[model samples]
Target: MTATVRPGLADEDLARLRARVTGPVLDPSTPTYDEVRRVWNGAVDKHPAVIVRCAEAPDVVEAIRFARRTGLPVAVRGGGHSIPGFSAIDGGLLIDLQPMKTIDVDPDQRLVTVGAGVVWAELDRATQEHGLAVTGGEVSDTGIAGLTLGGGFGWLKRTCGLACDNLLAAEVVTADGRVVGASDTENPDLLWALRGGGGNFGIVTRFTYRLHPVGPILYGGALVHPAQRTADALRFLREHASRVPDETSLMAALVVAPPAPEFPAALHGHPVVVLGAAYHGGLAEGEHALGFLREFAPPAVDLLGPIPYVALQQMVDAFTPRGLHYYVKSEWLADLPDGVVDALVDHHLARTSPLHQILLHQMGGAVSRVAPEKTAFTYRDAAFVVTVAGCWQPGDARGPHVEWARSAWRACLPGSAGGAYINHLDADEGANRIRAAYGAATYDRLIAVKAVWDPDNVFCGNHNIPPGHSGTRQR
Candidate 1:
């Protein structure tokens, strides 16, 4: 209850929020107000006195009724890749939703309804033009609605699962501004808190997945290794990422080497480890579940085979772009112990920046077959999830890369499988790691569905879910 950032709005509240938002109402004297309040993490330099570039769902219900008639503070930008700078907010009223571009494919019921500024490379190039696909975002311009409402997984997450387990319907905008519709028979507890329950309890804008038949080509790629065999490539990718096959998805990262002339100018600034396979199915069962990448060792560059599932979802789009300066710290392991590969090779060889990296992902098949109450992303037996990515670029000093990703995730939090990964946390890990990313009966049924749809918490900026009572967890 401490807003105080109103040195700007009120010329009849910007003429009644520009006569109820038709899109583009920005402030700080508009003229494109710093390019619609820049977002994709340049370590987020915010200044939101009001932005509102929303366009549909009645421009996010009149920008949540003009952020509750000017008490302001509300943020929500879809493809603005919110890595902790909760999509931009300083004295707030963001609601950008990147100009709500719509998508909508159907290909004889594979289904695909986008918009919420659809991103995962435009919903994997409009669901791969009917070859169809879904569990998206391994970076292809992330933001398939904040990675499927904060619980997405990539490379077909063990063959089709987490993207909030193929959502199916949404279109929120609640905090009293009304306009609802979640699915599986409408408002099923707001489709179980928009599947993964981030963005608190509203402002979804549109999303309705449930597609599949992946790859118009698969048996995927990458197998790197070199930084002095990165702990034997993380003990050969934690013993073949538990013997592959959920149509093989495996990941493993660790990175550094980017001097990009397609790499290997004697492994540029060193440290490698790559390992990225991706199978969806049959190339002789994805080459016998990736023949343990032809038995490990001797891999300076392997580049596996077949490709296109939209070129492996735009394969790390030139090693992550959008104004770089992302800080992550992730967890959830349930395995991969070699003191977590010597704490991720002693923090990527004690590096400070060669654009730092770590990402490990390879959780269980079909993401542990879904059922921890079927939604609100209950980790589902995490088998590996590591992150630690504290990249650094714009004028550096993000306090020594957020203290090197919090001292290498506190040396791998006693091999935690306790929590973390509400989209790789990191807005200062509050609310006790968001109640260890949903525990205690799915955070007390998302605090009674955020007290019946944002009981005045008014979508308290991303990663907050307060609305009191039921087993109580207010902060």
Candidate 2:
């Protein structure tokens, strides 16, 4: 049905929109309007005029067409976890994809097909049933849409590849209200652009990925150490990471230990450096490889052991839930030098809030083998990707949390390769950062593709590139 031309969308248009989707339509007058509008990042406060919980691809198409015809801004939400709350917009139309989550696995071919709204946990559970897995977001609750769109980096990243790398194909709804499939063969150029191009090209409805034998069990978990040993731990981590097999992955976070029964009461609520290890091989080999990390001079807490991969992914999600203010900055480092370690240690010790954390994921292995130009993801050879995240209870504390995150980011900027990951970047970091994420040449190609698929910039809420007169679509 075509959109109604009446001001504020005549009641008839609302009825027509509701008729097209199986999910609920929430407006300002709806009882659950406020709840429906909330996103993962509490800091981003927006009030979209209408929220359409799309139940299928046709529902998405109808929402996009209606929003365009009405000349209203459209924001697409999958997991509601975009750092800047790009998933939702104020006084606009929100295309909520949460209700469309569905996962199907072809065990014989080792391929997994999932809807845009599927979260890491949902996909992980389904794939594991077939003794197969794919690279996914680190946290279980993270939406596959935002993560894959921005080129996912995770525990399996070094061993396999970014989530985008394993992507075999996708069904996307373009800005002009057309449905198309993108893969290495069909619409190849659009597929290339979608790899690490953010959500600028179109609204992805489903993704097909090549799966691997990951696990019901991976040998790894968090091993916490005292705050004073931060420097020593950091040095050891860097050296040990270089020697580990590609199948083994590790991540380190400097933060306060949560007050839980699993931890010693004395260490609870205190600053500590935690190491998360994941080894995708024999238990004996994993234990042997983890010996160096396990012998870290009487750790404050030692939770590292053999556990289900799905459980590990869900571990950190409990701490970083929705309705919390968050500010983040990320960088890819070629090497973690001594000076950089010192800076990280100093900042951690000086942190005024316990909510602050510095995340380091050792990158390489299968991820770097892919040619730079082969896909849209360009940061192929970096040694590590460090993310500085400040999550706090919203309200008066927001200022201090943001300030701490910003200061830490500024201090570490020089230590980086001069760019930020498009996924973790805060909304405040503007166009220059986006340009840096995709260098000059790549950015130019992305702009050219933007011209063909979305010349009018209907998908401007993401890290955007305006279309030009270039008739040839680049990338």
Candidate 3:
């Protein structure tokens, strides 16, 4: 069915839209509207005029058409995990892909075709059943679509590559209501854009990824040390992580220990530094390679050992549960300079909320071996990704939590690579930071591609790239 031609679509137009798709259409008055509109981030309180829980590509096409016809801005949701709440909009139309949760794994071809709504945990479980895997989100709850588009990183990244690197092809519903496929052979430029370009050109419905022989089990976990030893721990990590084998990946964090049963009650709620490591190789080799981390410092907690890869992926889920206010500031670092480490330790100690954390994810290996020009992700030489995540419960003052993250970010800027991981960036960082994320040349190329596929910028709800020939599309 074609869209109704009236502005501020009447109930009749909405009815027509509902008829075109085999999904539920939710409005403000609908009983489930509040629940459907809520995203993972509790801070987001947007109320879209309409929510279309799309079950298939045809439903997405109908939703986009309806938005265009009624002059409503469009927001697309997959897993509803966009940190900035990009999947929601105030008084606009939301195309939610949560119902499209299908996963098809081909063991012979080492390929997996996933619907946009499939989260990393679901994909991991399915793929692991066949002894196959792909580089997916560290937090299993993160959606495949948004993570891939923004250049995903995880424990397997050093051994394999970023999630985008494994993306072989995608099926997208473009702004003009045309269903298109992007691959090396078909619409190759669009495929290039999709490889770290954010959700600028279209709404992707499906992703096909190249899988690798990973593990049902691996040597991986974390070691926690007192906060006073943070400097020593970070310095040791910096020296050892750089020389580690390609199959080994590591991350360091300065955080307050959660009050969990695994942690000693005396240490709970105390500041601490953690060295998290994962080895994607044989158990013996992994143990030898990762053994030093466990012995580096006298830890208050030593949970490092052989663990199922799926278990490792979800280990941190308890700390990052839904319905908590989150604000993050991140930078890609070429080196972890002394000043940067000092700054991180200082800010971490000053954190107002125990839920906040300072994270440094080791990069390089296969990620850097891929030439910079091969994909839109420009920070190939970055040695690490630094993030200051400020989190608080409901009823907490927003000003202090946000300012803490910002101040920490400012302190680390001097040592930054002047670019950030696009997926880790916040909405308030604006266009200049977006340009910096992709670099000038790649950003220009993204804009050119945006002009070709979405000249009017109908898909501007993400880390948006405006069409080259037009001003920013009004949301």
Candidate 4:
């Protein structure tokens, strides 16, 4: 794969871009250039020729215009957490939105308006202050823009919908450098597309989300069992989770116990199967809902109880810290066949790295209640999302780890819905996978929307949806 030749920007062009916005325009020679180009994934090592740390919408507009005029591919960086490094580019323009982290919570209307740069942790803290929240990523460090656009899933998803489902409005800077708004009463078609249509259309500057009444503290934690008990644990989870109330969201994982103070020293670095349950309603009711799992079997560690929502959100942060070499392969399963369970257990036991984890997140609650046509997200009917993640330190060889995830994904594909979560996809998964992420009907509709908003495919760095043959490239 040869690298694309980046269109050169003349000195006058650089000066013009600098004069058009209030933000600082950094070139590769700048002292902070390398730091600005670094994304959360250590595997991506591209260096953009220019980086614009946008201060506001106007800066974003100027940056897009600069890219268009110079013919430099544009990459938008929100939380810099793009798993495949879509946020960074080689010798192109990187629109860095990290400086635009302003959040305004309107408790009166149960709405929270946040800048695209805001992460889930910041939003969770602010919304929890007023006893309200929207569905956000489990990892608090994930950016709101990328996660929501890719159809977010979190602990609150069963009780509430996905993050995109709660999105009421958005401010986007289109390909032609015009600021536009998308909402129910505004550009509703664009709003529908923005809900789950990756960044192919434009750059989102702000988002307004509808909040739901939730708790600052919820009964949620993990119950760990021995690795050999994975099949039994998963079988119990499958039955129990199917009948669990919407207020209860469940996730089962095969992970190695880290050497943290929370785990027993004897079990440190040991492989374990954990059933993590979170109930969003009253503490007593939550405990009642989670009682079966607590008493089902004796575990090495039992950490289920009333815990702060913020603490639960940050609980996995240690396992997924920034700069780790990571690769993820996921599939949406309509039903977990018995063979799939055996394969999952076998893969978990044969994992190349102890740090690797395989997760099964129970879907179908509020997530399924929404009509598929209502938004661009089409995977609402899935019963569970199976994610195979390979993680290792910097010096580790990438082949075995990546192969582990890919092989596991192949084994589980037989029981899948033939679709995937866009956010969890890897760079190697090509355009065909992108189309599969959005079903055939939704993919065609998204193409029409992309043609209307970005005919030239200016935002091609993401899980790109190119304008089809019907679209004429706009100057």
Candidate 5:
């Protein structure tokens, strides 16, 4: 049930807002106040004055215009996975897009059009039904909007490309409150700006990405190893990563084995070096290509084999559940130095939270082939994307978890290229980090586009690039 406005908003204002949309408007006194305030990163706690659950494209337009007219901040929420809480704004308006999730497949042209709210799991299931796939977020629960808008990464990168590379078109609501369609042919500048660029341009209503014939089931899963073997595992994986074919994409995570039925009873609550993988190839070919991985001693358990593409996508979805205190930091590594691996192993053992993890994803192959200028997404030649994530409950444990993530991230930066992935980054990185992510040239172009589309900088909560930057620096 809706609550009557009591604090900042007046009764008349609430009535006007209610008249603009058919969806429910949740204020501070709403029954589900606590639940609606929650986001993927539990570390971020924001209370938007109103949460508008949009039912149609026009509702988004109305919400944008209303927020602008009333001078209230507007946050767009799809999967609520914005680590910095791009989904929620203090004393503002939140346009919750979760209800708009829908996927329409054009099998004839190998394309899939997805609503902004659709998660990776939903999209993977839909496309895999036709023996087709598109690059998506590494975690299943990641919303299509934030991930694709910020340049999504996943198991299919080496084989196909990034999520942005597969993008065919997008239906967006600009800051000026106009609905527009963007693609290579139409609004080419806007299309280029959207690629790899975070949600600085507008609130994307729907995304249409080109698809590839991936699998109904193919070789994929994790190879778990003991914590003691972490060093060896890291070295083996890094050395072998480059030699693997484009059809094979792999990543390794240092994490504690959860106390779940899927994990070994003895290994429960203990740290493990998990080498997870997915190969878009037949069993025999995948086996032949991945033979080098077996040299690190047989895995504690080999969950690898022919599994449905959708199944592989959802494999780690449960670990990163909807509402958890999450603090993540990332850097792009051109090469994994010997000392860096040792530091990572040390940090893995030092984590107080069992949910803490460090992930190293192999990037390049087809991903690197994309031109630097074609889109706002840069760093085409980076070897890997390394993310340090701390997940825990809020309260007494918050400081320790966030500190652990920061320490791990700082320790690993010396071996990195000093660039951050917009999606995996925490708020601590701030604006300077955004500049580093998109070099001088790309950032300048993005700012010009921002001036044209969102001159007032209405979408400023993300890895923001303000309107008047001559280049990457503040000056």
Candidate 6:
């Protein structure tokens, strides 16, 4: 099992690797290789030399060992939805975790344990059955691994804290192909690193989360207005965000209405500003906390109502379906001033791409309450996290869409807190942006963790935090 890592692949070594793993090992020649390699991002078209559909941590350990022996770059795919396409690799080894879909819920303990491959929807469905949930990605299809590892946000974020915040423990296969458990009682520093440190130190095979009571239904919905009202909506969100209860999540978006039967045909293919709100507290308080959206000049479309928490999490699924060509840039802004609002309206909102949109997630409450140094997810206390996402079909020209997204992101950067969300970073944003995601101290600490668990950086495919020697191990 221990082969000296070299920078070339050997057929005999590959054969030995295949013989050691329990999962299905696939090469490019395999009939289903193409299908197996496909990821959720249409923009990604990587073809890893070997694809290991890991069924468990042992399978992962073998794959990592083989890849390290061959010195082949490695990529890990959980839900297969890395916006920056880190879930795949070109001519390397792909550790596809999708086959590890084991999930268990302990209702009495208020906890849920899942394999890395589990997506938000699958986990949400299981947890909802037990009347417990955690803060997950807004789009249900997003993989739990990538989201939680990079500071997950969603409707529950403001009230219940981030997905990383709920993390209790994890079982990961370190770079050296050793199985390790990370929790307060064991390898606690690794647990802290896994909370929001990206996939730097190791590959997580299983996760344990502390769940909160989230019943079947919640008060939440969206209010849509004309695109011309972008500024008005932005201003309203800016003012309204500060006073909203910790149990409430108020967010906004500027997007083109999809031509679905549920929406007015006349409004289809056009831009609009959407104000979406959710409350996990009392119904009466929820009404009072979110009624401001309706009073802002009767919306063109009002879909606000009492809806199931699971259903509410899926409201964004339509616009963010699998395989959509997407490019994203984000910023953490303390407040949405007039200049920022104008920048969005004049530069981004004026243009319309069917699925492209600007999203503003109002942040505070439980998320900000956690000290910046509590976890590797140091980007905190920002009034809002704004994202400019350009989405289009695969056949369309990617240039214009990418450029448009970049332009909008740049316009908002000047008003930002000089940092980006680790999860939202585009591949091209480079190291500086990654550093900005976690300020100096936090980033340094993360690097130290990486040094301990993954000294040679075998898992460098994600928003990587390379192993370092300067800082002492936090444990």
RMSD of 5: 2.1
56, model 5: CA deviation in Å? 1.4
lDDT of 6: 0.86
TM-score, prediction 5: 0.96
Instruction: Judging by lDDT, tell me the better candidate of 1 and 4.
Output: 4
lDDT at 368, model 6? 89
Model 5, span 1-475: residue lDDT tens: 3444445556666778789887777888778877977887777888888888887788898888778867787788988888878788888889988888789999999998888888888888888888999998878888988888888888888878889988889999999999999998999888888888878888888899999988777788888999999999989888888888898888999999988887889999999999888887787787776666777798887887778888888888778876677889999888888888998999999987988889999998899998887878887888888999888866645888888998888887767875888788777676668888887788888899988888888888777888866543331
Q: Model 3 misses residue 166 by how many Å?
A: 0.4
Per residue, candidate 6 scores C-alpha lDDT tens digits across 57-138 of 9999999888877778899999988889998999889999998899999999998899999999999999999888999998
Give candidate 5 misplaced runs (Cα > 4 Å): 1-10, 470-475
C-alpha lDDT of candidate 2 relative to the true structure = 0.84
Task: After superposing candidate 2 on the true structure, give the runs of residues whose Cα lies further than 4 Å from its correct spot.
Answer: 1-7, 469-475
Worst 10 residues of 6 by lDDT: 1-10
lDDT of 5 at 446: 89
Q: Whole-model lDDT for model 4 versus the true structure?
A: 0.89
Q: Distance from true position, residue 213, model 4, in Å? A: 0.9
Query: What C-alpha lDDT values do all the predictions have?
Result: 0.81, 0.84, 0.89, 0.89, 0.84, 0.86
Among residues 3 or more apart in sequence or in different chains, the pairs in candidate 5 whose N, CA or C atoms overlap within 3 Å are none
lDDT of candidate 1 over 98-143, digit per residue (tens): 7788988898999888889878887787778788888887888878
> For candidate 6, what's the RMSD?
3.3
lDDT of 4 by residue, 1-475 (tens): 1122244567777888888889888887778888888999888899888889999999999998888888888899999898899999998899999888999999999999999999999999999999999999999999999999999999999988999999999999999999999999988989999999988888999999999998888999999888889998888888887899999999998999999888889778888899998999999999998898877789889999999998889878888878888999999998888889999999999999998999999998999998887789989989999999888889999999999999989889878987889999989998789889998899999999888898888888888887864233432
| Model 5 Cα shift for residue 371 (angstroms) | 1.1
